[model samples]
Target: MQLFYQNLLPEINYLDQDESKHCIKVLRKQQGDELDIIDGKGTFYKAKITDASAKKCRFEIISTTQERKVAFHRHLAIAPTKNMDKMEWLVEKATEMGIDEISFFQSFHSERKVIKIERLEKKAISAMKQSLKAKKPLLNEIIPYKQFLKETDVSNKLIAYVDFKNKIHMKNELSHQQDTLVLIGPEGDFTPEEVSLAIENRYKKVSLGNSRLRTETAALAAVHLMNLAME
Candidate 1:
């Protein structure tokens, strides 16, 4: 089923400007037409269009359903890559695979110091609609690496690091049915001091795999692993 997103649902029954245009002008939806809407907070609504205005198409709710609760929550924290396209790709794929939250941080070896959270959020919204997911992953702005390490609280905390002898795979480290957060470093990888600090904060050092992966790839891999653990 095709789904339109409008975070404000039962409270305010109208699509935003962009969504309104798509529903009316692009898709040619008319008054009395039925459509599915998601609030991006695990709620889905079945509604009938009341006004087909291209600027603010309004709808009346027919029914509402909440998304099924997952066995575990997956949160991925990573350093944004130097290339914006790569980061966008990561967000899109991770959303499709059912990530709960994504956090970005600036590390000592981070190549990209700044990121546009709004753009990434748009990508996530599109991916959620495409994948027929009712919930949208929370996209957080870039913060200091140390700050994230200190503030993050989850049942299972992991840091993807390059350590030949560490030998602990991320998949093996994850505990079933627990909220997990994995940290992926930047292109240049995390500094030793940063890894040490994360360990001090109770983040376990884990390896994604034998082969070295890019920052975005590592983050997606972590998300994928977390999803698998839930299954």
Candidate 2:
């Protein structure tokens, strides 16, 4: 089933401009037509369109229900790549693969320090609808690497780095049905000092694979492995 996103849902009673345009102009949806909507809060609704205008289309809710969250929450925090397109692609694929949350961090060797997460959020929303998922992954604003490391709280914390001595893989490290947070660094990779600090602060120093990966690749690998652990 095709799904649309309008988080406020029956309370707001309408799709925002972008969603309205797609529903009215692009998809040619009309008044009295039924559509599925997700609030990104795990609630899904069946609604009948009240007005199919090219902008600010309105809908009335027929039903609403919440989906069960995944057995485990997979949160990935990564340093943004210099080319923002790669980051965008990562968000799209991660959403399709079902991540619970994503974050950006500005590390010492980060090639890109800032990301326009609004665009990334849109990509995520589109992916969620395309995947027909009822839950939306949380997109976080970019924060200082050190600050993010300090403030993050989760059941499990791991840093996927280029460490040969620390040879444990992510799939082996992740526990079943537990909230897990994994950190992936930039292209130049996380500094040795930062790795030391993360290890000190209870972040496991783990490795993704034998071959090295790009920033986005490593992040996605971590997400994939964590999801695999529960299977």
Candidate 3:
């Protein structure tokens, strides 16, 4: 089924400019054509086009369906890489894999201190629509590493970093049916003191695998592990 997104539902019955153009001009959808619409809030709508205007394609909802709530939440917190393209790739893939939330933090070794959250949000929305998911993952603003750990209040908190002595794999450490939050460090990795601070805050240190991975790769790996554990 072809899915379109319109965050404001019931209250609003028109697709925005971008979506309108895509539906009318690109897809050649005309009045009276049927379309599937989602509000990115776990709600789906069966709509019929009323006006095929490329700027403000209007539709009337024929039916509404609410999706079931997920059993657990998968929140992936990481230090974004200097190259935003990599971070965008991670966000897109993670959204397709059913991530519930993504948080960005700046660590002592963080290369990219600044981030464009608006751009990432667009990427996430496109991915959600492409993957045919009705719900969109929460994209959080970048905050200091310490602030993130202190503010985050999830039950299963984990930190993935390079530590030979800490041999526990994230997959094995995951608690089934519980909300989880995993931390992935920057390319330079987190400092020992930072790790200690996380531990002090009750975050368990875990490993993704034996092979060392880049910042984005490590973050995606943690996301994948969390998805698997939930399954």
Highest TM-score scorer: 1
lDDT of candidate 3 over 1-231, digit per residue (tens) = 679999999799999999999999899999999999999888989999999999999999999898777788889998999999999999999998889999999999999988999999998999988988889999999999989988998898999976788788998887668999999988888899999999999989998888878888888889888888866
Error of 2 at 7 (Å): 1.0
Between prediction 2 and prediction 3, the one with superior TM-score is 3
TM per prediction: 0.97, 0.95, 0.96
Model 3 CA deviation exceeding 4 Å by range: none
lDDT tens per residue, model 1, 117-161: 999999999999999999999988899998888788997899999
The segments of candidate 2 whose C-alpha lies over 4 angstroms from its true place after superposition are: none
Residue 76 shift from truth in candidate 3, angstroms: 0.6
Stretches of model 1 off by over 4 angstroms after superposition? none
Clash pairs, candidate 2, are none
**How far is 58's C-alpha from truth in model 3 (Å)?**
1.1
TM-score of 1: 0.97
lDDT of each: 0.90, 0.88, 0.91
In angstroms, the error of model 3 at 93 is: 0.4
The lDDT, on a scale of 0 to 1, for candidate 2 is 0.88
